[model samples]
Target chain A: MYVYNDFDETFVRTRVAQFRGQVERRIDGSLTEDEFKPLRLMNGLYLQLHAYMLRVAVPYGTLNPAQMRQLAMIADRWDKGYGHFTTRQNIQYNWPKLGDVPDMLEALADVGMHAIQTSGNTIRNVTADHFAGAAADEIEDPRAIAELLRQWSTDHPEFQFLPRKFKIAVTGAAADRAVTRAHDIGLVVVRNDAGEVGYQVIVGGGLGRTPMVGKVLRDFVSKADLLPYVEAIVSVYNLLGRRDNKYKARIKITLHENGIETIRDLVEDRFNAIRAGFGGYDQTLLAEIEKSFAPPAFVTKATDGYEAARLANPAFRSWTDTNLSAHKAAGYAIVSISIKKHGATPGDATSDQMRVMAELADRYGHGELRISHEQNVILPHVHQSDLPAVYAALRKADLATANIGLASDIIACPGMDYCALATARSIPIAQQIATRFDELKIEHDVGPLKIKISGCINACGHHHVGHIGILGLDRAGVENYQITLGGDGSEMTTIGERAGPGFSADDIVPAIERLVTGYLDLRRDPSETFLQTYRRLGLAPFKTLLYPSEDKADAA
Target chain B: MPPRFTPKVVTANALLDGDAVWLTEDDHWSPLMSRAELITDEAHADLRLLQAKARASEIAGAYLADARLGADGPEPVHFREAFRTRGPSNYPHGKQVETPPQT
Candidate 1:
């Protein structure tokens, strides 16, 4: 894991002190709610339905054992003994008193972390592939670039108060685990024909009321010009993006209104102008940041033992098959620990579980842990020989769930339980569906299906991109859910369409069961996943199952 | 009704206790008053005092929107707003009393 430098340490400490002063002023009645609200939001404090929620950024989803331990401590002391890891790889505490927020921020700063820019209309925490350095298919580590962007974007005087929040993601591998395409700016690290490293720049991608797959602005931007190029893009958007309406404020809407080609030309024009000003600074900064992220030296080890253990234990084999990925280094594998336990709340980890993860990261995974966009934790560089020990520790902590990309491994937001904006409960719906699927032992049979839930149209859970998306809404004060099929969150991204009529909170699970059973019945074989089948036959069959009465009524 | 501005009783945090209290009509702040004393009775002296305090506190203050009175009762004002109108601990509302000179 990368250690914080003096500059990084100083920045976070100063921010914490500033926030503490603000909080004291608010308490002393020198600041009004309207005056204090933006300041608190800038530090990622939200006034939710039941209590004040504080979101802490896990930068690039990377944390050292000490940082993880500190998170556990924060959960135990300030929060409700648990933390919810969001899809953006941030951890949110549902309950925290307004007075205690300064203390909470101070505690975070002690561990080189803060909640600054975690919320508000500034550049958000830069996300990257959780398996960045370790993934076999990666051209280079994306976190190095992500970290550079983080340093550049944090409180950048120009971009601080944009029309709306901006999100950026980077991916080093072809698999796109970071969901790069669903961000305001997506950078896919690639090597050109001459073997020089650069980024395939994509712009205008986002998810909300309007979801868009980012359009490629540049085929490749040289590694040296990354920051200046990004600045240019953001600068253009900041100046031109809609301010009249909050709904149409995102860069995507701006790009839509003023054609992508025009935006691209403008970005290029700006990039050309500023490229000279950033001359040697970007290279020097990138080099400095890269030094911080250099991978640890690994001794060659045999994976024969790992294969032997897998053969001996079918459960281990199943887990290895689904939860493990090929590592860049031989004899090492990237292990993804699924936070989505069958019937438990998704993306939540208890204090004990967090401590165990910290311990496991220290023992078997180079003391580095990563929180993935899919709402799971990754032991990035675990030696194959140490797999058993790590798995055993995880099992003890109730963190060893084999379902990683299966149907039961669902991504859901906090929903009405915590969010005042939410219309219905998403967590419970996801829990019931996961539990039902587990009971049926049909998750594996269903194959890799992404079932994402969002409480409302905000799309915090990214329901728009799920293979089987469920959106929770309130109809006359009753919780109702709407289903969408044939969605995907990948290079081939497509927004899912509404299946049919909405189902009551009670009827939701049954409706889902009906849809899944329908998929199972209609599938050519078990090899055909829900998404594959849905894509092959379109949404007709699934829609038929969801709205059978409607079909019958139409027929009659 | 063209968005009638009701006679609202606003409260603010006490410098010592951080409790919401009704601002009394005699330019004095009363500590720990009930929601009924803050609102509902337009003719009540306590409610009138609260209203006066609320107006004065508007210089630089935050209203706690989430804090509301119980059902079938008068609306409660925030505690923070009260303290802003009246000064801090070193300065008390009654002790630092300045009677306006007759014009």
Candidate 2:
């Protein structure tokens, strides 16, 4: 993990001090709500439907054991004994009191974390693949670039307040685990024909009311020129992005209005103008950041014990099969602790759960942790030999529900339950669907399905990119849900298309069940996953199944 | 023809704690929905909204919520306001967790 230096520490402390004074002024009748709203948002404080929410950035989804423990302490001390990990690899405290937020910020700063740029119309936290350093197919750890972007954009005067909130994601692997294509800017680390590693820059991709797959602005840009290149992109957006309408303000809309070629030309011109200003400073910084991400040493370990445990315990076997991923290091595995336990709040972890994860990271994962964009915690480098021990510890904590990439591994936003912007509730729908699927005992059989739900078109839960997407809406004070099929957020990113009319909240789960059961019969074989089958056979079959005619409905 | 006026209440999140509170007949914030001042006149609703907004130091994002007097007290007519009254259904937190049963 990247440790904060003197400058970083001082910078965070200064921000906290500034926030403390701002809080005091607001409470003492010096600052009005209007005056304090933007200030509070800049520091990651949000007044939601019920309470104040404080979002803390987990840079590139990476954390050390100490930082994780502090997060647990903060949850227990200030929040309601739990925190919600978001799809952006950030942790949110939904119940922090406004008066106690300054203290929370201070505590976060103590452990080399801060809530800066976690909200507002500023460059937000730069996210990377959760399996960055540990993935077997990685070109390079993308966190080096992610950290550079974080430092450059934290309080960058040039891009402090853009036309809209901008998001950036980087992935080192060929398989896109970071949902790179759904971000405002997506950087895929790819090697050029010359066999030199560089970024395949995709610009204008975003998921909100309007969903778009990013256009390839530049096929490849060398690592040395990455910062200046990105700065140029943001600069172009800052100039050309619409200011007249808040809904049409994002760079995606800008890119849509003015073609990618024109935007590319402007970006190149701006790149040349400010490219000299970077002065090779970021290259030097990148080298230092790369050193901090050096892989831990691996020792030869026996796997017989792991095999024995798998044979002895069926639950452990099932968990390992679903939750373990291939690691770059020999005899090591990337363990995904499914925070999305069946039928509960997705991405919610209690203080005790957080502590157990911190301890497991310390004992078996080299004191390191990574939060996936899927809302699960990752022990990035666990030795295969220690799988039994990790599994046992996790089971004791109720953290061992093994539903990664399955039907029950659902991604849901806070929805109307907590969000002021939500039109319909999303959490209960997700819980009911997961619980219903578990009761059917068909989750494992369904296999490799991503069910993502968003409260509204904001797409915070990434509903637009799920294989089975459920979008919650409000129609005449009643909850209505719309389903979409064939969306894939992988190397081949495609927005899922809506399947006809919406389903009421009550009828949604059964409707989903019908869709999935119909899909099982629609597939060529069980080997073909949901996405594979949907891609192979178009939405015609699924559409008919979802909204079957009176004749077809009676036949069933 | 003019649109009929609906009963309303001035609601806002308390600045210090960020919990939902409503303006009362006595010009104070009460966390309970039943204690909220029910406004049937449009002019009075606007006046109460302005009065609630004036207390900026004590509250944030004050606005009129659509509600009506039920058999008990002020009950939310819209689902959004109903959620605010009882809190989120996913968990027993906020007003639902700490508040006593409705009279």
Model 2 chain A: weakest 10-residue lDDT segment is A545-554
Candidate 2 segments exceeding 4 Å error: A549-556, B100-103
- For candidate 1, write residues A1-556 as lDDT tens digits: 5667899899988888898898788777787667877998999988754357899999999999999999999999987688999999999987677778888898998888989999999999999999989999999999988988988899899999999999999999878888888899999998899999999998998888888888998989999888889999999999999999999999999998999899998998998999899878868978988998899777688778888999899888888888999999989999999999998889999899999999998888888999988899999999999898888888888988999999888999988766757777788888899999989987777788899999998999999899989999877646789988888888788889888878998899989889888899999998888888888999788888888888899999
True contacts kept of 2: 0.91
What TM-score does chain B get in every candidate?
Answer: 0.34, 0.91
Going through the candidates in the order shown, the clash numbers are 11, 0
Q: Per-residue CA lDDT of candidate 2, range A1-556, in tens?
A: 6889898999999999999999999999999999999999999999999989999999999999899999999999999899999999999999999889999999999999999999888899999999999999999999989999999999999898899999999999889998888888999999999999999999888888999998899999999889999999999999899989999999999999999989999999988899889898888888998999888877788889988989999999999999999999888999999988878999999999999999999899998999998999999999999999999999999999989989989999999999999999999999999999989999899899999999999989899899999999988988899999888888899999998899998899999999899989988999999999999999988988888774386698
Error of 2 at A517 (Å): 1.3
Query: Which segments of candidate 1 are over 4 A away from where they belong?
Result: B1-103
The model with the greatest DockQ is 2
Give the distance in Å from residue A178's predicted Cα in candidate 2 to where it truly belongs. Answer: 0.9
True contacts kept of each: 0.02, 0.91
Q: Interface Cα RMSD per model, in Å?
A: 13.7, 0.8
